[model samples]
Target chain A: MCGQNMLDIEGLVLRRGRRLLARRIDLRVDRGAFAYIVGPNGSGKSTLLRVLAGFGRPEEGVIRWSGRTIGEWGGAYRGEVAFLGHLEGIKPMLTPEENLAYRRLLVGPTGWRVPTPSPFFDASALPDLPCQRLSAGQRRRVSLACLEHSAAPLWLLDEPLTSLDHDGVAALGGLLARHLMAGGTAVVASHQPLPPTLVPATVLELGTKR
Target chain B: MNGLLGAQLRMIYRARGDYLAPVIFYVLVASLFPLALGPSPRLLSLIAPGVIWIDATLASVVAFAGLFRDDYDDGSLEQMLLSPRPLELIVLVRVFAGWVSLSLPLVLLAPLLALWFSFPPPILPVLLVSLVLTTGCLTLLGALGSALTVGLRHSLVLLPVLLLPLATPVLIFGAHAVLLAERGLDPRTPLYVLAALFFLALALIPKATAAALRVALEV
Candidate 1:
């Protein structure tokens, strides 16, 4: 039970150019916990998630994973994070399976069995076509499939619901529930409401207090 | 590592046009020199090493300038950054793939260009070896330039200005090696120096590229 809050940020400041977006912020999310970052446009929701995922530097403060600063954790920290930004990260020339396969391989061996073919996108329906041929929603689903195979304990999803259909949302809800049950943590930044099942989650609103 | 390499190779395979464009450009540029310089065999052979080297350098610069641009735009580079694998390792694999796809063809075609330039048969091997070293160095340097400018608009316009200056040492040594070999003198010293530069770039550029990419992502 020691170091229960596996993800911790202390006295954080985030700025976009000279304008301050978030300041003197503190956040902690334990394993299996869920946190929602909700705010209007340009509120730093995406920026916050990007910082949490170790992409950008916070203007001030430290982000600690499992009691170690992310820089100290280095590649070890990256091993535990699966970040999905607005771009989807899908190589359009590659099929969904190819994208997911390479995604899994890039993270190195997690000792987790290769996940049974992703339930997010049906192979029969979509076929083995290049992601370029897939619809935007289909591509989004393909990116979601990467999460299913990632085996990373922490997921920092920035607007993951973008372009997802109702069924896709339901599917994502199911995936989130299963992941939480399996002792995973998720920090999501979104404008849309998450499924009912994901309630009892901490909501961190940006741009309002300041 | 093999998986990353394989994936990159597959990308090169699928995007054949982008890789082939540089090779075709090298061929056209090299062929143009023979036509422009007239049929003087001595003059043709005299300029062969320098012309071939400059063409190869330009071709590689063009091909590799956008190396990280597409990946950066598509967000795949960010995923690569998130991987537990060292960023330097990923950068190395990517540059190696770019070399194999874009530069290797130029090397394979060097013999034909040598024959056209009427290069001495004995110096042909030297030409090939120097090109291999020079191209590898240029690709590594281009990868670094690509990483630095990936975040900016009009990065392609800025790429050559940043890369060509850094590539001069490689060009000088590589061309000088072939020129020496053509004159029946020992080309080993310049070749050795080219090899040292290649090895040194091989050791350092990937790390620098990785750091540049990390900073690029911060913006």
Candidate 2:
């Protein structure tokens, strides 16, 4: 459903309550671009990513996906964006498989579906075990499976490395690289530098001057 | 979404405490009238409809607090707003499933609770019907309450303040239906009113809830 349309942000302003976080931020990332959103704490890295994700609206901005404005896209905007954040977005009472399966269904695709475990996440480990019983890392992995199953063209990740072990990080990085290779766009908010292999196509750094 | 509904269904299965709390509260509150008012059958029967209705309303309010809190806590509310379906559909399905999972127990136990209030066999079916329909009204309204107050630290205090005003009319219609049934004064009119309220609430409240949830999560 997407062509080579680039994501464009023109003269954006981001704010939290009364405090202005970023001013007149303009950026452009072509389709399939991997843009690392780097910023110090309180610098609005997450806020900018959120605007792209359509999670929370910014104070003022114009964001377009594949040449369509966010407002014009309406409910269909959700179809193209995948957002994963620090909260893991998994229900504690649901088992990993159940959570993954349910999230897949949440996007409204039809036909028989099943949760497939990823090497990064052991969602297959005790498929019936509720998320509350899983350790923090394990639960985070289950949440990662939600990301793996999504078909959206745009990925917005906010501090997504939380609670992941070394192997999990490698697995995720590999997936990110693969997603870029497959012509998907991503805006990842993280301080960690990308592995040399996928040195992100561009860097969108956010923060007011010191 | 069927996926959301299935997940919600599984969620309630694990939360035995949440499911059982309202029924226990319903019983305890129903039993309170007898102790406080001195167990005269006349007084008990006279106040029975209001007592059960009030308890049910209170139980529904309590049940709704957890409804959207989890969405906020786990950050699923943000994702839910971004679901491919409109936010209204998500709120509708979740609220309907929540009503079934949490409040339906109270509906099933309504007859027994009514008996405690001296509801005779003749009025029992009407009482059940009233409870079922009002349960839908309160739950839809409560879903709106839950959405509007989702992320705030003080949302619990605000919930009742927001919900009670909306809920008062529904309760009156529900209780009056029971009273008319007890007196055999052609309870059909109030019952029809209750059904009308139910359908209106079903049609409209979820859209309001979805709007409120968007404000809560996005703004």
Candidate 3:
């Protein structure tokens, strides 16, 4: 019921052994906004994104979605968020079409029986025949396709541009722009600047430790 | 309703190598015992129960090695944990898929293997039924073991060590069912006990597997 902000983190801190990955970081992403988290390796950019995706707990401080704590949202509310990490999450053995169908089945609306049988189910439209056989860029595209059908309000992407070629990057940039233009919020962790169209986006940069 | 089950079914069907390998291994392992025991009908029949049970149990363990490994490696496990379905229910579906891919085929081929051992036809039904029931238990138990050892370096060895003891009752009842049927006596007691073990594992292993996955993921 609480729909104030899409995401909010306050006094968040994360530590690995004696080292601080992120220290007392306060960040917020309003509904429909595009935000980028930038940092060098080991600067906790991925860690921050993972925390917001609800994949990890902050050692200190709190993360709130809408107006409630992340843990309080329950499974249904949490399902409204999709995450894409650096690793291509597609199953290597599954054809691109099957991978997309499976992902849709995982996050799609209820009563959505698969083998969706729609023209969109064609594997040819996908970047490759199957994920394992695909080029790195092609695999990333397949994963992106899965993300597009997620129907989630929020997207948490970590280094999504890593293996993408020029065209692939532009295509992804266009998708993110479209997503934000349609009132969806996104938090991206990447070193590259997205296309200019994805403007009005906020940037949070983490400085190197002394 | 369809979301969880559909994802599980796809995972099983698409990973043909992971799914089929264990059943083939089961048949090969079971077949070896008879060949090693030298085609003596009496000896083959006498040891068939033990051979089949051991092979089935070992096959369950082999099949489970990939249960969470694929998901973990591909990063799908995190997505699954974060999905709308309860982790326990999702774990159950994964176990169900594992059973179908690994144990179900074993059950179907069990009778054919029994024939090679000259097992009596009357006892064949009991052998098949016992295998079906016991495999269910092994699948559930194996799921728990796989979840616990998800990221461990020695999970290949650890899984069997963890699961074999828990599978003892299943072996006992399954073999007893064959023994009773061979004498032309009703094996109802052992059959019921095996069924009960299956149901018990079906009821409880999901929660245990879920908890184990949580710990494994955190580590």
Candidate 4:
């Protein structure tokens, strides 16, 4: 278990358009650990999360997951990583239950028969209408529901707290605790602080920290 | 794979407009030929094969214009990119779902189109066979064009223009196949060529489309 189950980045340089964002960054996060990416607006936190999720290429440097380069791991690596971007990844035409069921099918072996409701809401209380008819906070909860059924080991979440209620935050805190305890690793990019129940192993600030 | 297919089919069902556009467009364009050319059965049947082939080609363009644009905009394309399965297989499933929901209707409507063109009843099966192969080729090729333009703003205006030239070969062979059948000839030569083109697209286009999608996500 020399390289073990961990993410290692070295001399990373990332950019957006013509402007370079961050340079010479190195970090590591082990299994059962959490890393928080924080910075002000336009700080490349989201870009870093995208790179970590294997969506974008770094301008310079190498990222190794569990001792293998992501290119080498390829689909095997993607199968283990669950990504949630700013768009929330839900179809507006499908209900919350339908969304969660489809998500579960993609990441796990579950059939779409009986979808488990979002833990953030009452089981019988979710509206049967399409998610587009729901409020912003409700849609965010549905997006968070993907994390619950994902069963993916590495969660790369960007702005998971964008539109959640107090109860939704608490439920997410609980879910994160369970995932970490089960030996899952998470890399989150957020403008606000996560719930107080869990502490991050590393806080990597992007751009120029004030 | 079954799960992806099921979810995709459900989405296709929910967004009825996307699939319906091609079917409606095909029928409307095919009908215009009979109207615009005057009602001589000899003249209509003579040009029927080319007219229907062109209609299918244009319909395919409409069908595949937004193949990946919605997913790209909504970030589901990003999620699909991250699926554990090979991207090529995922792309193939998507194209297959599109073919079923968008192009199958055109195949089903063959008899009506044949009737309108005064095509002989005996040639109906041949026409259907040519359509199945031609549409499959056009859809696969259009999926590649769609993938390349997924992240661009003007993709809708550009897709058909780029695809029509590339699709010309399929149109020629498919129409020729049916024309031969109408002339009471074997029609096997052009039919074999259409089969080859369809199989070639089947073998190659999904991989290319998947690669294009990966590039689209990068920038």
Candidate 5:
């Protein structure tokens, strides 16, 4: 793992089609920092998270992770990131257990730092069943399970709160708290306000895009 | 690296049922030509090279829908896009796995299919060689097409349109080589062209497909 835990975004200008989504934005997040990028519908929350995740290039900006430019880091940076986009990324034909089984491979060698699913994980009804048989909330849980044992220090979650039940929401908050306590960083893009029980995080809410 | 490849192989293995449809489609298509043209063995032998080549190409297109569709729909594509594994290598492995599971059967089954066409037995080896090499080239091109269109709605139509112009050369050289082998003439020229295409695809298409996949996944 790199010795640094900082994400520095300077003068970020994001666009979609001909419209300006979010522009001239700057933010800095240090190790163990939890950040929420809140925005209304069509406000570029997903686009911004995607840009930071290296899925989409911003029109203008520099994003630095652990002191290296994400571009220069290139494929190496992917190993350091656990990105969960709007989709659960689940294979409907495979069981939940089968899906997350590939996580270690995708992230490369995690050695012994793979986080085990704990009592707080609420993995009660997740395994064994083909993912197609699961409900939306159940599918969300299975997808989040990928992050439960993630070795990557950076988590880029897009709309993680969608379709989650109260219990599922609390489980996610607990996981986030644990990740923060362990010195990892998370960038959660959601329109929903976080539950009351979670730890405080730096909030970067984007105004509505007309 | 082993883990990544293992997981990819596992996914392919688990989806063994999916590989059947295209091969079956290939046979069904080949069967139609014999029925349409009547039972004349002489005529069947005459058109055999073109008939088999067309079906093989179409059968690969049948396999194309599955190439990236499952991953894109269920979100595994996102995981793959962001995985620490090099996108180019991931694409290469995907194409390789696809060829092994999906196209290898078509290659193995070609001799039997060739019998239906009354293709001269002497040319079977040459047919297999052409199938194996052409299959690799098609899979590479098909993958690049799949990656480019994965994020689009109604890309099934778009895929073939994008692929056909590029695929015309593969068809020309592949079928021509098989015909030359049939006639007992030296098929070296087209065989060399197919080899060149395979190596070029091996070196270049993965990077292009990877870049296309990145664009497809972008919002």
Candidate 6:
């Protein structure tokens, strides 16, 4: 995926109500690179992530993917990016396996069905249970499973490590390394350090410009 | 299209327990009015229209809470918002799912409730017709309410306040239709009005709900 920059943000500004969260920010995440976005609380890290993922439009500036403005990228084109916000985004009523299967159908290639034995087939073996009954770390793992299986070429994660244990964090780091190694790109927003193994990542500190 | 619809249906059915609870509440509420009014057939008949209409209206409001709360709590709403599918289409599926899980049962059980109130036999068809149309309108209205209160706590109070006023037309038409039917007069006028209201809601509410959800999510 490194032939071109998969994500480009220039002169981006985001505001919440009367407060200016971020201003005049420029960021770029190329194909196959892991980029980290860090800032203190209310630093607009989530805002920037939302804009980059095409969920929230920037107050001012342009976000482009592969040379086309994000707004210009139609549904099919934008589908190439997977976003995980602070919210776990997994339905509590659904089991871990069902959540993954549902998301697989949503963002997977059109006409794609969950494979007979899903990659996360192991999730089904644990128990027939609702996600709310699962531990926070377990829910996070289920969400990560969905992200891993998504065919999207770019990933935008907000606080992806919020509820993970040491092993879970390491597993996520492994997933990120594998994704990058496979030529996929990612922009992660977090206050925590990523696993040491995934190196040479570019870091952008929001609000540092002021 | 298939994915959005299928996901919505699955999510709604998974909350089957919550959905069924409101229908049971509706039956209980409808039954209490007759007993409280002392079982006088005249008194029961006199208030039956209002009783059924109130019961159905309250049931829809109660079920509306489950429409977006589960999805919001589970993070499913955020996931859907970011999906390749148009937000409008996704919101439509949600509204459809809410109707299927919450409102559909109420319509189906209207006959039984009507019997309990000893509604005139001739009025039964009109009651069912009014319910079918009103349920469609209520579902759309409820979707709008759900979108407004997406991430807020105490949404239970906010939902009814926002929805009940908007639902007045449905309640009015529904009760009137039942009254006309009981009089053995043609209830066609109110029934047609309710159908038109449902169509108007169907044409317009999904887009409104979608826009509301987008704004709510951005905040």
Per-candidate Cα lDDT values, in order, are 0.85, 0.80, 0.78, 0.84, 0.81, 0.79
The DockQ for candidate 1, computed on C-alphas, is 0.75
Which model scores highest in TM-score? 1
Write down the TM-score of every candidate: 0.95, 0.94, 0.90, 0.93, 0.93, 0.91
TM-scores, chain B, all models: 0.98, 0.95, 0.95, 0.97, 0.95, 0.94
Q: Which candidate ranks first by lDDT, i.e. highest? A: 1
Better of 1 and 2 by lDDT: 1
Worst 10 residues of 2 chain A by lDDT: A110-119
DockQ of each: 0.75, 0.65, 0.43, 0.61, 0.66, 0.54
Give model 3's share of reference contacts: 0.46
Superposed on all Cα atoms, model 5 deviates from the true structure by an RMSD in Å of: 2.6
Alpha carbon lDDT at A187, candidate 6: 90
Could you tell which candidate, 5 or 6, scores higher by DockQ? 5
Clashing pairs in 3: none
Candidate 4 has which clashing residue pairs, if any? none
Q: Please give the distance, in angstroms, between residue B142's alpha carbon in candidate 6 and its true position after superposition.
A: 0.7
Interface RMSD of 2: 1.6
Ranking by TM-score: 1, 2, 4, 5, 6, 3
C-alpha lDDT of residue B65 in model 2: 73
Determine which window of 10 residues in candidate 5 chain B has minimal summed lDDT: B1-10
- The residue-by-residue lDDT of candidate 3 on B71-159, one tens digit each, is 88888887777677678877887777777767889999988888888888777777888888998888888888888888788789888
Return whichever of 1 and 5 wins on lDDT. Answer: 1
What stretches of model 1 exceed 4 Å from their correct place?
A: A111-118, A121-125
CAPRI tier for the interface of model 4: medium
Please give the ranking of all candidate structures by DockQ, highest first, separated by commas: 1, 5, 2, 4, 6, 3
C-alpha lDDT of residue A10 in model 1 = 87
Choose 3 or 5, whichever is better by lDDT.
5
